[model samples]
Target: MQVAVINRSHHPLPAYQTEHAAGLDVRANLDAAVTLAPLERALIPTGLYLEIPPGYEAQVRPRSGLAYKHGIGIVNSPGTIDADYRGEVKVLLVNLSNEPFVVQDGERIAQLVFARHETVQWQQVAELSETGRGAGGYGSTGTR
Candidate 1:
């Protein structure tokens, strides 16, 4: 899949340290000066604008290394980037640690994965067919 990206700043993106990496790493735009404290969350700008094709979306995800090492992660986890949106890619990060987290410019903040999604079509019916356990929800069956 091909995606259109715009670099608002001159800062280069962070490269993955290992080969055969699954996702492309994104960095924070240090010029924005975004910071967060323990149990706090902030929206950090990446300075990257994307143009995703129709029928597809870009999923903004957290890097495992950053989540594990810094005790920080994406608040929405896999944030959905709509194909029609033509805006700067920003990351909502939450610091779960006790210390304040400083997000420097050009720091690896997140990863983006492009995926295709199908548009849903709904149909209305007067009555639906019934099954043995029809309309059962939320542990209607025995736990054992």
Candidate 2:
């Protein structure tokens, strides 16, 4: 689980925990500032780069405190970072509040979690087995 981080600005790299950690902290770029108006979206630089091994992916997620308090959240919640991508890690933030939102440097913008997955192959079939609740969606069952 080796990740390469690029310090674009003079700011130090954000701290990371490896032992039963809840989330990977993503910090805002101190060099570049961000301002998002109501319902506006902005691509925020994290001033970090990552190197993920094959068969694994880094999922970018929004912080609950930031989203609930400031009305700011990741535009693409749980954005996927492919294993083979050797690009800088960036976050897309959207301000859902009524007023403008200012993003300062070193601010905890989001959280990233690394997960491993397997690529499954799909097979064509003429007919599929039906289940008891086949095609039931969106609260179709009784909410007990």
Candidate 3:
């Protein structure tokens, strides 16, 4: 719940926009604007260092508004920040549109969501259990 964090940027700490919001809006920390041409991808810094608890991770996701308005999307959607990671949080963003996209300092670029995950140990089984649609994938199930 209470994860330790260090803020190195001038922007305020990341926070949820609303009461029921699942992710906190994280801002871009840059000295100057960074522009991404069409199909260009860049790693944008957040200047945030986090100390997440064991069995938990921080997920960095794209903002819908930025994706819809400026055709900006995270190259690695929902990037995972492991509990032991102590480096700055960086977002991999790509310009999806024909026009260039500008990333400004203090602009909310990504959403950070803390999640609890389970550690799995391999059972080393030769076969997996069968299911109703075993081995069916890539739209093998109809869209209705």
Candidate 4:
């Protein structure tokens, strides 16, 4: 699906590294580097504005390589960009390691994944249909 976007950064538009990648890698748009102390979080800009279509959302996700190598992660894990939102995309990154992590300009800091979503209509039901393990939550179903 084609999407409408405006890029104001020096870096190229977000792109999929592989032929079958689910997300497009986004870069950090900054004049200088940002250093994040351990356990610290910062909002980094991408200089990207998007017009996400209705019935869809753009999710900001962390790169597995960054998380595994530098302990960098998105503060919201999957930050949601609603269809109606029209603003610059920024990533909230947190340093989960013991040392500081530097966020360089044009660095691939996060990923943007576009996905379709459903709008929910409230039924206001008195009860939901019951089933086996009707009230089970979380680990109720044994992990196999």
True lDDT of residue 118, candidate 3:
100
Q: Pick out the ten consecutive residues of candidate 4 with the lowest summed lDDT.
A: 135-144
Identify the candidate with maximal lDDT.
Answer: 4
lDDT of 1 at 124: 89
TM-scores for the candidates = 0.83, 0.88, 0.96, 0.96
TM-score between model 2 and native: 0.88
Candidate 1: worst-modelled 10 consecutive residues by lDDT: 9-18
Question: Which residue segments of model 3 deviate by more than 4 Å?
Answer: none
Model 3: per-residue Cα lDDT at residue 107: 96
CA lDDT of every candidate:
0.84, 0.83, 0.95, 0.95
The digit string of per-residue lDDT tens for model 1 on 9-93 reads 6677545557977678888886666668999999988788888899998888998887888898999989999988998889999
Off by over 4 Å in 2: 16-20, 30-32
lDDT tens readout by residue for model 2, 14-97: 556566766778888756577899999988887677778889898999988899999999988899999888777888999999
lDDT of 4 by residue, 1-144 (tens): 878999999999999999999999999999999999999999999999999999999999999999999999999989999988898999999999999999999999999999999999988978899898888889988954
**For each candidate, how many residue pairs have backbone atoms clashing (under 3 Å)?**
1, 0, 0, 0
Q: How far out, in Å, is residue 74 in model 1?
A: 1.0
